[model samples]
Target: MNTTEKVQTCLDFIDQRLENQAEQTIRIAELIIEDIKNLTAGYHQAMRNGNLKEHSELVRQTQLNWVNQLHDIILEQSNRDLSGQVIQALQKFVSNLNQTQMQHLHFELPSPVAREYDAQYQYLSQEEIELLMGQQRLFPDNNDSMH
Candidate 1:
């Protein structure tokens, strides 16, 4: 099959799965909504205590945790229900592509080995550092040397 046909077939498969899982999906959504309501209530109580500045940080952190949990739940569900089927379909799709078509295609799959980086590394190139220093010199009024 052509690329478009293959893609449409995969999408149709996903749509069918979604239809079958509609009830479960709705229940999961309701749970997420309830959690959001609780978070909002806590935020309001914190606001009323007149310690909003301090409490706001805590509220922000809690919201981030909730979002992360929601992401994990969705990923887990997708892996459990769809990963194998999707992998098989994709393998067939790639196998069907002609040599020229395959040469033109590019993919950026995640690699566990690529995750590590030097935290203390400098981000700016030498040219960028020089350009920034030049810009600083142009704004003499705001220069630290004046102080």
Candidate 2:
């Protein structure tokens, strides 16, 4: 498929996934938050116990387990949301292009739409330039212009 078609397909798949998985993503996030909170409380209780070293070690292990669980949940949810279609599309696109052509290709940002009251036509006062100098001197003074 051509680049434009591939991009559109990926975008359409993403839109569908977002629509379907919005609720599930929010639910996963809530569950993860609750799990982390419970883990933190357990760790705090372990810290306060008589068997400091052993309890701390156990808590540390438990924290690692919780982290891994959280990671798995996020990965699973993301995979479900994306469904791997975008990755497949991009792979196909890359496989179709030649090495030299791929190397030379670059994306350019679209130019902003012109406004009737754009700042380019408005003159900055000397004080404004001085104040802006501390941040960024966007427009150089006419006196500083190289003629």
Candidate 3:
């Protein structure tokens, strides 16, 4: 394979890995939701039985477990952010290479990455915008930075 094809293969691998990470995160979130429901039920049962100690313990466990899960999800997202930056840079490099080597090289690597980035900016979903808006509300003092 030539340089463009090699880079395209690498990019495809990274994209697949990113997609896997996202799916894992979603699975974690679903698990967390189930845990929350079970924890809530346990708390209610302990309260009905007047087991204050058990109720307190359940509360503590719930808090700690959810916090840990949240941390794990955040770390996963951070990894994706770094990977995304690498992908973005690579896409730019590929675009530049195509420009400078068109005459010398003969290869076509269709730029899905470029369109993916553009699509994000051009057509963000309402839910996504609301999520960002919620974050903004959480950090009202923070000045907005480039996403």
Question: What stretches of model 1 exceed 4 Å from their correct place?
Answer: 1-31, 83-147
Which has the greatest lDDT? 3
lDDT (0 to 1) per candidate: 0.70, 0.67, 0.84
lDDT of 2 by residue, 39-107 (tens): 677767766775667766766776687688668767867786566666666666665665658689895
- For TM-score, the strongest prediction is 3
Better of 1 and 2 by TM-score: 1
Q: For model 2, what is the alpha-carbon lDDT of residue 104? A: 90
Candidate numbers sorted by TM-score from highest down:
3, 1, 2
Model 2 CA deviation exceeding 4 Å by range: 1-25, 77-81, 84-147
Q: Model 3 segments beyond 4 Å from truth?
A: 104-147
In model 1, state the lDDT of residue 89: 76
Full candidate order by lDDT, most accurate first: 3, 1, 2
Candidate 3: lDDT of 83? 94
lDDT of 3 by residue, 1-147 (tens): 998999999999999999999998899889888877887788778878988797788778877988998898898899899999999999999999888877787654355654565544455578999999998778767355433
For model 2, state the Cα shift of residue 137 in Å: 91
